[model samples]
Target: MLFRIKSFFNLKTKAKYGLPLVLMALITSQTNAQDNRSFQIFQFPANKIPTIDGNSEDWKIVPENYIVGMDQLWDDSGKQPKADPKNLAVSVKIGWVKGLNRLYFLYEAYDDYWDFSLPGLHNDTFELIVDADQSGGPFIDRFHPNPNLTNTMDAYFSYHGVHAQNYHIFTPAVEKDWTMVWGSQPWIKNLPYANASYKYDFKPGQGGKLTLEFWITPFDYAGNNPSRAVESILEENKNIGLCWAIIDYDDVNKTENNGFWNLSKEHKMYGNASYSLPFKLMPLEKQYKKEIDAKWSFKVVNMAKREVAFVDESEGEITSWNWDFGDGTTSTEQNPIHQYKEAGKYVVILKIQGPKGISQLSKVWDVAVK
Candidate 1:
């Protein structure tokens, strides 16, 4: 009894969570709550990963419940609770695959005024910030935790976007790169780090709906040196921080935004990782759930008594189970203790059945007691 208590307390956190204990402590200490509501990011099956080719067909498999509509956003610049759909409407869906350290986004928006005539920041844009590990703190040099350093060129390279990344994504980039990563590591906005595609028909200053598909790899530490940068590890049920804003300009000539629709309640989400809301990396939908696997283990309870204890350790839901002791005897109990008439090496098998299907496991001459 004491051994069991000690084992539970002494278990290594790193082995259980795939993160070291010290790093977990640092993450817990740095985190801040900007938004109370938690959002869910759909887990796309590896085969169903959306292609960044301006197509909506691939995202059809995602359910509507995952949509983050304009209703959820706060108009930080416009100071409106919700934008008039006739003037501006937006919907966003985020996705992730199990092993890939990348985030996929499908952005759909309708604007009464599409202003992208400018060569630079004057255009309509989607600004995004992500703290992949939810290791929250200031990401920009201006808000650097180290108070003394001048928010100069030196601090820009050393601290800015090192813990979190920011991207000013062009809604429909005309003659420019798709996005501008707001830090020293501009490389993060290109090729292997990111890709974007847009589907729109209207000319600059014309009104139309736009569909933009994009994917970006978020980093825990991204500096000028890509070789030394650390990409955040994405896993099931973990929470990350993400904030985005839609920057709109009614007229192409103006340098300021007509509206800024933000996913976060606070405007400072752009520079502070703490202000980015928690987005959970959810498990796959029911249709994509893994099937049950039959597994079991046995220990000799008493050699003189010819008794053994069997344990069922199957994965996934199971309604029923059957175990074969290879001693011409069987049991239906999930975990059973059985006594054999004679001592001998015996093959053991366990079978589990659930809604998905049935699974069976067999061991040959594995369990033995004398």
Candidate 2:
């Protein structure tokens, strides 16, 4: 019995004391590895984007209902197209891969009408060229045969020219990837685009999956801020705060109204940077027993400094919130209303929780204080 007891004591001593030290060493090593994992954008090597079937390419000529040689100034009083070709568009797809470092992009480009000019004179060959690691930066140009000109076999003339440009600058903490494309070159001026996109194959030091896709719509060119209409659409949602949307405008706040909001630091399955209403409106236990059919209710109000409190009770346990100053700023706190010291429209958002999960609601209210 004494010999068995001695062996058990030795085993427990080693496990209770030595095991934790080993775990600590392993965790510290992992932390150090994560601290050193950082990356920057190396120029994507230029390649000839092959045209498999020119006629059956993914792009639709004169997309968004804008046609060639037509008097469509802007998509709908927003931004104009870039050049005189009627419309400029590119459609791309990539085959899925197992890792983030290596990949391929298949793209197709088209003009407004393919060849809007000569009747039965429909011989238009296209070319896709990427100018990467250039003197300044990377550029993608779509080449087209000039309708009025000809080549060796009496085909239309073709040349490579960029309709838009894409480049990225990375800071140690924040990665800035930007793509600028125009709606119409000279015909419409207001709405040049900040491509609504980013590369999702990011290495956050940990092996994980990040994927994104964008839908680009070319609207009629509004002189210089074609994104104004898109902004208005976002404004309706009022989730524009802490976000950006790029266009040919000089507004600072409006700059972030476009692309995907990066939330990698949150360490969630899918990262998102958004606000939440963390309170609950529940019936008292006694009230619940007595009046099972009686409904429970609550309010949310905004009391932040120099901000207005606007409340929406269209849904959820959060019934109403007060706006102390009728300004666009708001909060999800019970009975919240606020007053602003300045005059301007503001974007407001709300979060509500239910038995299933949490949800977000947003709206933009224009407030002019007298």
Candidate 3:
């Protein structure tokens, strides 16, 4: 139930009569119909969801496989300008998590300065361009006009003092003409289902670094609906196009500097291009099936009277545990203490349930009578 811009309302007539209630109802119903659509599946290796607090401690366990460096991006302005390495020498580590019907992003930007004073394209910002439908035709070109294109979406974010501002690009146009979906405040306070945080470094000598964490639904864009409600744009399409860029502004010369992580030279404009890399957002349940490998060790506390206590030191998310005391008796406690009537050589077995199904480990223990 994709709602094209033309089918919904006439842009010219919005000022005259505004959007009719009937048309609004139609768009909402179509968006709701997307619930039955299939979604792309992805399984993250970590179980703990990352907190969107501008701190990346939760991502320590995850691998930083996606690396976007400043050197890889092209100069769209064609100035052939040389930028200070101290400010431009930056890299970004990106990780994705899909949960609660929303997409989460963990971005770590390594830079020298964090500036947020300038306005429009002159400000230090992180930009994201996405093609929700992946229909390769009318791409987003900042310098060119392609009104026939409607699938691309763009977002520009900057941190200013205690709050952060997100500038959303409604159409495939240049940075100067792009409209701010959320108004007035320097911070993003009006977005319905979006949240983000950033940590900036102001210390000298050591390059400034920032950790940005945020989450948004696929339908959380201005083009989708005027209300900006949570919808399944990703689920409706299954595949999407994506690219990111880091913009740096030099206040001394009033010039713009840009760097990208995953964008191609042809599509290196300040907005999303229809002809870009494709990404599939899959369901977690389909990718969560695997056999768990059990690893554990134990410490035995002797009671000195044929009684001993066993402590479980295991890794991973263990749901249930089974312990065998070697004397034809068993217990379901994670760590259980067993007392034998007499001294003997016995084998202890531990069976645990984890993400990878069931696994067991065994060790030999000797008990002496006091």
* Model 1 score (lDDT): 0.87
Return the top candidate by TM-score: 1
Which candidate leads the pack in lDDT?
Answer: 1
Which stretches of candidate 2 lie above 4 Å from their native place? 1-214, 217-221, 224-307, 310-335, 339-370
Tell me the tens digit of each residue's lDDT in model 2 across 1-370. Answer: 3354345446667577776665565565454334322211111112222222322232222123211112211222134433233233333332211112111223233233222121211212111111111122111112123434322222211111122212211111123222222212222211233222232232322222222222222221122233343111211111111111111111223322111111111111011111100111111223213211212122223333543434444333443333323244445464355566665555445555554445554445544343
Compared to the true structure, candidate 2 yields what TM-score? Answer: 0.19
Worst 10 residues of 2 by lDDT: 269-278
Model 2 has an lDDT value of 0.27
The TM-scores, one per candidate, come to 0.73, 0.19, 0.47
In candidate 2, position 269 carries an lDDT of 8
* Candidate 3 segments exceeding 4 Å error: 1-47, 78-85, 93-99, 119-121, 136-191, 203-207, 220-224, 227-230, 233-238, 252-262, 267-272, 282-370
Candidate 3, clashing residue pairs? 40-281, 40-282, 40-283, 41-282, 41-283, 42-282, 291-356, 292-356
Name the better of 1 and 3 by lDDT: 1
lDDT of each candidate versus the true structure? 0.87, 0.27, 0.50
